[model samples]
Target: MPEASFSRGAHHPPTATASTAAASTAAAARGPDGPGAGLLGSLAPLLAEWLPRQRWFAGKGRPVTGFALVSATEILPSPPGGTTPGLLHLLIRAQQPEPPGHRHGFGCGHRRGAAASDCYQILLGVRTTLPPSLAPALIGRPSGGPLDGRTVYEALADPRLASILLERLRVPGRLDPLRFVREPSSAIPSILPPRLMTAEQSNSSVVYGDTFILKLFRRVSPGTNPDLELPLALARTGCTRVPAPAAWFEAAPPPEGPGPRPEPFTLGVLQPYLAGSTDGWQLALDALAVRADFTDAAHALGHATAEVHLAMADALPVSVLRRPQIEHLAAAMSERLDSAAAAVPALQPYRGALHAAYEDVAALGRTGRTWAAQRIHGDLHLGQALLTAERQWSLIDFEGEPSRPLAERRRPQPPVRDIAGMLRSFDYAAAVGGHDTPQDWAGGMRAAYCAGYAEASGTDPRDEPELLRAHETDKAVYEVLYEARHRPDWLPVPMTAIRRLAAAVR
Candidate 1:
C-alpha cells in the first residue's frame, strides 16, 4: 500500500466528490527528459493549505511546503467565455518538512531531499462561476496561477465529470502517461449515471448506476497496487468470494528516475458493484442493536476468509518463514511498537507486556520453529467484508494498510495477520454498537469465527496461541496509533484490546 491507496470504510453512495514535478508544456513539446510539469504554478499556495485538509492526504502531521507537477492532462480544458466546467487530471508531489527526530524509510515512495514529499492524485473541476450544489466541494479560488479567477473543486463531486471517468474505463486506451485497460471478456455499459461514494478515508469511489464501482487511489506511487493485483489473482483461481476487477487504469512511471525502471502505478480499479449488500461492520452493528446473534455471520465470514486465503496461496507466491525470517518479523513488530508508543503516550504502560509477546515469537524462532507465509489480505476488518443479498460473504479492498510501502503490502505474510484484524473489528463493532456486554458478544464471535476457519482450513488459528497473540497485539497497537491521530473518540476501542492483551501476558 502506498501512502496513497484505497480504503473501504463504507460503500454508501452521491456525494460530491497528475504528475509532473515542474516540467512545462513547452518542455513537453521539446520532449524533455523529465516526465511532465508546470501545471499548478500559482495554485501551489492554495494546494499547500488544501491538500493536507483532505481525508486521503497521508502527510497529516506536517505542514505542506509546496507542490510540483508530476504529470497533467486536460480531460476537458476550459474554453474561453464558456459555462461548461473543465476537468483536469493531475498528479502533484506534495512537499512537507520532515518531522524532528524522524527516521527515513517510514513509508515507501517518499522522496527524501530538502523536504519529504508524497505524490497525490487530484481531479480539479474548473468553472467560471460556482454552482450552489458544487459549493461544498470547493477547494478554494486561487488568487493567481494557471487557474486564475476560476472556481476549482473536487471533480468527482460532479456527476457529469465522474461519468467521464467511467467512460474512460469503458473504452480502454492510453491518455499519455495514464492507461485504461479492461478485461477482454467484460463490457462496461456506457452512460451509466455515476454517483460519488461517501465515507471512504483513503481513496475516492464512484458507482456507475448499480453495475460497477470505480475506486480512485488518492495517494499514489509507481507500482501495481495489490487492490488490483490480488483480486485479479483470486479471479484466476475462480474465487467468487472477492469481486474481480472489470476495468482498471494505471500511470506509467517517469522514465528519468534512478534505479530500476519502476512498474506503472495503479491509479484506479473498476469492479462489479454488489448493490443492496450490507457491509459487515454495519451488519454487526445492526445485529447488536437488536441483540441478535452475530456468531453465525462471523462463522460464515471466517469460512469465506479461509477460502480466499487458500486460493491466494495457490495463486500467488508462498514462502516459509524460517528461523531468521521469523526472528526478523518479531523484531519488526517490536520496532513498530516502540515507534507507536513514542507518539502515543497511552501505549507506554502496555509496552513492556507487548514486547514480551513479540519476544515469545523470537523465542519460538530460537527453537528452530517455522511458519508458512502466503499472499493474504494484508488488511482485513469487518468493514472490508460484505454480506450480499444471498447472505454470502465477499471480501473487498485488498489494498492493505495505506501507510505501508507498496512492496511490503505485496510481500507474503502469515495469514493470521488478517484473522487478527477481523477479530479486532468484531470487538470494535461490539463497542460501537454499545452492547451491554461488549466483551461477551465479541468473545463469542471470535471463538465462532476461529471454529469456522478450522472447519474450512482444517487448522484453528487459536491452535498457535503465541503467534495469534503476537499478531493481535500488533494490530491493536496500529489501531491505537491510527485512532489517536485520526479519530480521538475511537481511541478507547483499541485501548481496551491493548489492556486485555497486556493483562493476559501478565
Candidate 2:
C-alpha cells in the first residue's frame, strides 16, 4: 500500500458535460438497485488489501474477512470530459474475526466481540485515469462491478473534492442518510482553501485557511461522538478550555438493519482553528530539549483540565461510584492486565505486583468508600492538549481511545482516569526527551500539576493515593501492550513505568 499522501492537486473546472446515456450507465452502476448494485463486491478485493495498511485502520493484525456497503452517495458525477474526478462518499463496514479471548460486549444494544465489524467513513475519487500527483492516494483499479476499470483513490487527497465537503457543512440540510449540520449563527467562509494535515493520526484532519480544522473520523460507530458531544456540552457552560464545534455531520443509521439499530453516527466535526498554537506534547518535548522548567506550564494545564472537568460536571450528568461500581472498575483493570500480559511477555513478571494495585481499589470499595464519576476526556494526555501563545490550554479530541468499544469510550468514569493518563504522559516525555534523571523531572512536574488542580478544584488527587495509583497502573499496562504491538523500540518507555508502578505496589 502507498503511504497516505497529503499532496494537493490544482483546482479545475467544477462543471463538466457527459452524454445522457453515459450518465445513466454510471448512475445505474452506482445505484442501489442497479445491475452492479453490490459496490463492495468489487471494492472489497482492493480494500481488503489496502485498508489494513492504513495508519488509521483500527483492526491491525486481523484479516479483513469481507465488506458491506452501508450507504454510498455520489457527491459528484463523473465528467465525460475527464477534467475532474467524481467524488463518492461511502460508509462501508469491514468484517474481521474476533480476536482470541475478546469478551467486551457493546453495551449500546449491539452484538459485539462475536465478530469484529467496523464502519469506516471513506471518500473515494473516481476517474478514468489517475494523475501522477495522486499516485500515493490510489486505492487501485477495480477489475469488475460498476466501478470496473475506473481508478479509485482517496478523495480527500484532491483539493477540489475536499472543498465540496466544506460546502456541504456550510449549509444545514440532509442528503438522504447523510446529514450536514451547521451550528446556529455560525458563519463559515465560502472559499477557504483546504489542506490535509500530514500528521499520522487515528483520523484525518483538514485545515481550512488556518481558520478552521475539520476532523473526519475514519472509523465510525453509531451515536454521538464524544469529540463533538463533550465540546458542545462545555460550550453551553461558557467554557473556554475547549474549542466548540462550528459545524458537524453524521450518518443516520439504517432503520431496518440485520441486528440492533443504533443512533446516528458522527462522521466529522469542524471547529475554529487556534492559529499559532502548539500541542502540549511538542511543547513538553521542546521544554525538555532546553532543560527548561515545565512545572509552570504543567500547572496551567492542570488548571485548564480542572476547569474543563468542572464545566463537564455542570453540563452533563454526574454520579457516585459505590462499592459495586468500584469493584467492577477494579475487575476491568485486572482483566486488561491479564490480556496485556498474555500479549506481551515482559508484563508477566510484574503481573502479580500490578494485580495488587487493582486489589487495593476493590479493598477501598469494600470499606464503603465512594468517588465522583462524570463524563471526562477519556484519553487525556499531553498530545491531546493544545497550548496557545497566550499560555492558555485548550483540550481537544474527546473521542477517547479508538481501540476500545464505543460504549466503553462513552461511559462515565472517575476524573482520576484523565489525571492518571496525563501523569503517564509525563513519564513518556521524560523517557523520550533523554533527560539524565527523567523520573525526577517527571515527578516534579506531576507534583506541580496536581498542586494546580487542587488549587482550582479544591481537591488534591494525592489525597487519594490508592485511586490514583490504580489508574496509573492500568494506564501503564495499556501502554506496554500498545508499544509492544506498534513500536517495539518504544516498549522500554512504558516498561520502565510498569516496573516503577509494580515496585510501588509491592
**Model-by-model lDDT, in order?**
0.83, 0.83
Over 4 Å off in model 1, which ranges? 1-38, 106-113, 142-146, 257-259
lDDT per residue for candidate 1 within 1-506, as digits (tens), equals 01111110011110011122232432443244322322354456667767878889888878765555556777777874689888888876776676665666645333444566666889999898879999889987765445667888999999888988888888899887789999998988887988898889999999899889999999888788999999999998999999999999988755542457667879999999999899999999999999988889999999999999999999998999989999999999999999999999999999999999999999999998999999989999999999998889999999998888888898999999999999999999999999998999999999999999999999899999999999999999999988998799999999999999999888
Clashes of each: 14, 0
Overall local distance difference test of candidate 2: 0.83
Scored against the true structure, residue 12 in model 2 reaches a CA lDDT of: 14
User: Cα deviation in Å at residue 490, candidate 2?
Assistant: 1.8
Error of 1 at 215 (Å): 0.2
**Deviation from native of the Cα of residue 439 in model 2, angstroms:** 0.7
- TM-score for every candidate vs. truth? 0.90, 0.91
